[model samples]
Target: MLSEKTVKDLIDNALEERSDLFLIDLKVNPDNKISVVIDGDNGVTVEDCMFMSRGIENNLDREEVDFSLDVASSGATSPLINTRQYKKNIGRTLAVKAKPDLKFEGELTDVDEAGVTLEWKTKEPKPVGKGKITVNKQAKIMYDDILEAKVIIKF
Candidate 1:
């Protein structure tokens, strides 16, 4: 069985050669199956995945380790997992699930070490009018408040 540290070292070496590439997740099953998920600032391409796969394949001795590897990009619909992911997604629409049965959509305006700022619209009653008016609002959401968040694709 290949150690996780060894696998990480191999992947890290590959990423060191590439700019703007980050690892999202890495899993090594007991059956010697390794899965690696990666993302990039400009988005990851098939060639990038191939490059990472080849890098690991070349570093590890398949005959000795008896392992299977799978490397893939964190797709558009995948949930944002870290601060880097949130930062990269700035200026994009996100579907945020803050709590059970609580969800909202907003434009990600900014991200800091503590949390993210979102811009959204809400309907409020006007002071002198009978009808409600649309009001643009901004909210700061802490990282702890988020259960899941993903970029909303607009066609």
Candidate 2:
């Protein structure tokens, strides 16, 4: 078990120190469990997870607490799932292949708790009945959902 203040402080400090790895959010659920979400650099690897886990565990252990831990990285083609993730990706181009087999690539222009706005331009003429759509940010993904995402550099 862990105290909220303690967990919050630990997460905040770690996120601050390793900002290159975006600290999306943290929560101590009602079940008294701690959950951490982190967004990493484009090339985050297994080593990154190991580093974060050790850092978090080391600090928490020092406080005389025990808990289960899990750490992971954003996949090369994972969809941006939350406002925090989308904000971190602002100004970076995102390519998303949505359901119904639509492929789109665009600059991330805005993000909110509700959804995200992408400034996408297609080389071909617009398809019939194809209108601009806003995709709500999901906290997690399922296998059936289709999406491919990556950060593209644009000034």
> Where does candidate 2 stray beyond 4 Å?
29-33, 76-78, 81-117, 121-155
- Residues forming the 10-long window of minimal summed lDDT in candidate 1: 95-104
Positional deviation of 120 in candidate 2, in angstroms? Answer: 3.9
lDDT of each: 0.91, 0.63
Tell me the TM-score of each prediction against the true structure. Answer: 0.94, 0.50
| Per-residue alpha-carbon lDDT of candidate 2 for residues 1-155, written as tens digits (9 for 90 to 100) | 56768776766677677766765556676555666666765546777677777777778764465576666776545666645566677788777666667665777777655555667543443455666544433222222443555565555
What tens-digit string does per-residue lDDT give for candidate 1 at 1-155?
Answer: 78889999999999899968889999999899999999998889999999999989999997788999999999999999978899899999998888546687999999998888889999999989599999998878888888999999999
| Residue pairs that clash (backbone atoms under 3 angstroms), model 2 | none
